[model samples]
Target chain A: MKAFTTHFKNSSMTTTADFTNTSSITLKLEQVSKQFGNLTVLENLNLVIEPGTFVAIVGKSGCGKSTLLRLISGLDQPDQGTVFYDGKIHRKLNGHARVMFQEARLLPWLNVVDNVQLGLGKTGKGKALEALNHVGLESRAKDWPSVLSGGQRQRVALARALVHEPRLLLLDEPMGALDALTRIEMQQLVERIWLETGFTAILVTHDISEAVMLADRVILLDGGKIDLDVKVDLPRPRQRDNPNLIKLQEDILRRVLTIPA
Target chain B: MSINWSKLTGRITGWVLPIFLMMIWEIASENGWLFSKILPSPREIVQAAIDLSISGELAKNIVASSERAGWGLLIGGSIGFFLGLVNGLSRTADRFLDTTVQMIRNVPHLALIPLVIIWFGIGEEGKVFLVTLGVFFPIYANTYHGIKTADPQLLEMGRVYGLNHWQLFSQIIFPGALPSILVGLRYSLGLMWLTLIVAETIATTSGIGQMAMNAREFMQTDVVVLAILIYALLGKLADMGVHFLEVRLLQWHSGFRQ
Candidate 1:
């Protein structure tokens, strides 16, 4: 373990990270820590995400995976660290980033189109339509949100989050509530959109296979710290039957299950 | 088959019960089973209504009362709504005025009819004042409550979007509070009618309530009953009118749209 840490430290000192763009220093968390009352959540966490990387945070219940996303999304404040977007400190959301929650949270009063355009400014409607077309909901623009099926509603929510063309997309277990079939479909839709848009995406999920399937890097959080950072070398449109993904999922499971409470 | 029959019977009974009650009242009065002086038969009331209708007295009284109530509601409800918004949005204003307003609300406006008469004189101004006071509280209360209860998450969303204060209120807060404000309007309508009756009773010589008072003075119980029935019917119509307006304006609202 000492030799491994020393080797990792040596690699970090020699590493000269090349960002995809000069402007894409991307998202960085430096020695971040969070505490709620007396309970410590995230402690001395550090991560550097490249632009357009699809990263998944996986952890057991109460392991502060969602807290990490919230911190990255600027929904919550950090106690003792910084969240940098493109090397500048990111503060509260000012429409450059969007978060999609487990529930669709589409305003029921609005129809499909209007809800997509919601919170977006004056020129939002056209962009919203484009987004809806991306999600295959152009025909349901005038239809009320309540009439939509669960998957369709989630798709609309996806459109709403994307309509603004945000650089950062945060998904907080968005497919957690769906059934197995719908979940798989949604997972694929998410992956396709991420590929098409090339937005920096961060997802927090409990499903290890899902993390292994969708993420470029799966960060296993245990006891409010990164337990394992596994790089998924598999290519896009990965199959569920792929042995590499299966082994990676098993490895992540082992790391999480072995963590001391 | 049984369920359909039951639904059909329910519809029939809804209309049947009222008609049956009227019939019983008519029969009891005509046969002298009930005192006719205190309670006139339905036929007498209908005849009185026809007579008033033919003379155009019912129409004139309705127009006058409606005008007073309508204008009073328009002016008073608007003031109350703006004040409520101020009270909700500004803590300084709320702290300054809430106690005073609460004290005033406690004092029944009807009981101040004599005082209002002395202050404004026995004229249109006095009657309108009474009606305005009566219609103001519900609108004010509901508006304040609506604005106060607007979802904080939506407000946070506005903050995230870089919306200015005015834009936030207009786009997010106002639309969010619309349902509550409409509810206030309904309550104000009811209060408008109540105040109009008191206003006409004490001061006005020319409205529906005044007409009812005149009929009572002349011991024309049928005319009095007809006047009251007209007032009740008109109040119901006003409620329906507001409901129609609500549907038109808030068609995007899920409750009304569905």
Candidate 2:
């Protein structure tokens, strides 16, 4: 993590002002409700995230965790209430935020660097190269996305998102499709970057252990409402096998499994 | 050394059957086992080609045919591609134009040859018109399909990444649809040749098809055979051109990569 921070700092010094100023963001959702047809997905949900905080929303299928992330990102609007970003009501697509979807969603026609540059909007090949370096994928910068493994593709997606130096980074099960080992490596990479960059991150995941590993606070949703909000209160560079981490994971898992359909 | 030998044989493999068949035909025609009137020997066809080239007739006909094909493809392909872009990108345009395009596509273009002759006469215009009509639909249909079916997920990603409208279309939508559009192009290229062959056969003066018709009148079976061979060669050449284009444009596609 120390080596990664120093490397990122040295490389990022040459990038533009937009890439340098990684000012974090705060989010507040008040009485937010969303519905598709007759089915209410999120019902008057209320939450607040501090700047530079890593929060994970964990729930079963259709519990509306993903919907909440979408609302925060302003990809979808709440039917009842407003989502405030840094205390201002943001009702449209959040321009200051970027999402990393479950699928890498990298354009197959573009190579690694070009895909990252998509976040920078036609300029900033240098910034994009630095972002790829941050993800340890600078060597594959000229290679097509199709040639990369699933984990590698996600890393490129990470680079694309990070190139923007977004105030808020929303990850919608971004590591769900990865294998166990790759998932761990990606989590480490994301953790290291988050610590270095200090961007607010809201991750939606089904994995309890992942939530315990990465998030400072884990928000559990049941029937479109927050059922539990647990804080890790743990140190950085968390060990997966730590007894406290294991206990927290088990506790979250039990709570998730015991929730009635 | 062994690997090189196998590679060499691999290169020769595709030509082996065609060459063997030509040799057999040559021997059979020489022995009078096959009637020369029905199918001339390969050597006779080659001699006819040589004679025509010497007289500058073959080159003239080839140039005429190529110009017709090129003009038709340029005009027809542009119109089809333009219409496809407008319709695919705009729901209003799609609703207004797609049904009419589909209706016209159903009418056999070759069946319009007589009508075309009456309208434009058996001149260059009529033949070019037929080729144009023949090549338009596949390209239009394929381009439309390609644009319409561009991955929605990628578009959403583009939007989230703050890509503007033009960037979304150019970077995400167009590239996504390209493989399908190329398929359409290949299909239309084949149609271009087929339509030209038919139109030229029915019409008045100049192309390779006309040369074949002239030879038939004079009982120069070798010249007629040569025309057919030229068409086959031209069609092969057109297919190779499209393949080359696919290789160049879709190098990022795993299917197109070596």
Which candidate comes out best when scored by lDDT? 2
Cα-based lDDT at residue A93, candidate 2: 73
TM-score of 2: 0.95
DockQ of each: 0.34, 0.66
Q: Candidate 2 on B66-85: residue-level lDDT in tens? A: 99998998888988898998
Instruction: Report the lDDT tens digits of candidate 2 across residue range A137-195.
Output: 99999999998999999999999999888899999999999999999999999988987
Candidate 1 ranges beyond 4 A from true positions: A1-25, A121-123, B1-13, B29-36, B157-164, B249-258
Deviation in Å, model 2, residue A104 alpha carbon = 0.5
* Chain B vs. true chain B: TM-score per candidate: 0.90, 0.97
- The per-residue C-alpha lDDT of model 1 at residue B159 equals 57
Task: In model 1, state the lDDT of residue B180.
Answer: 91
In candidate 2, stretches whose alpha carbon ends up further than 4 angstroms from where it belongs are A1-22, A119-122
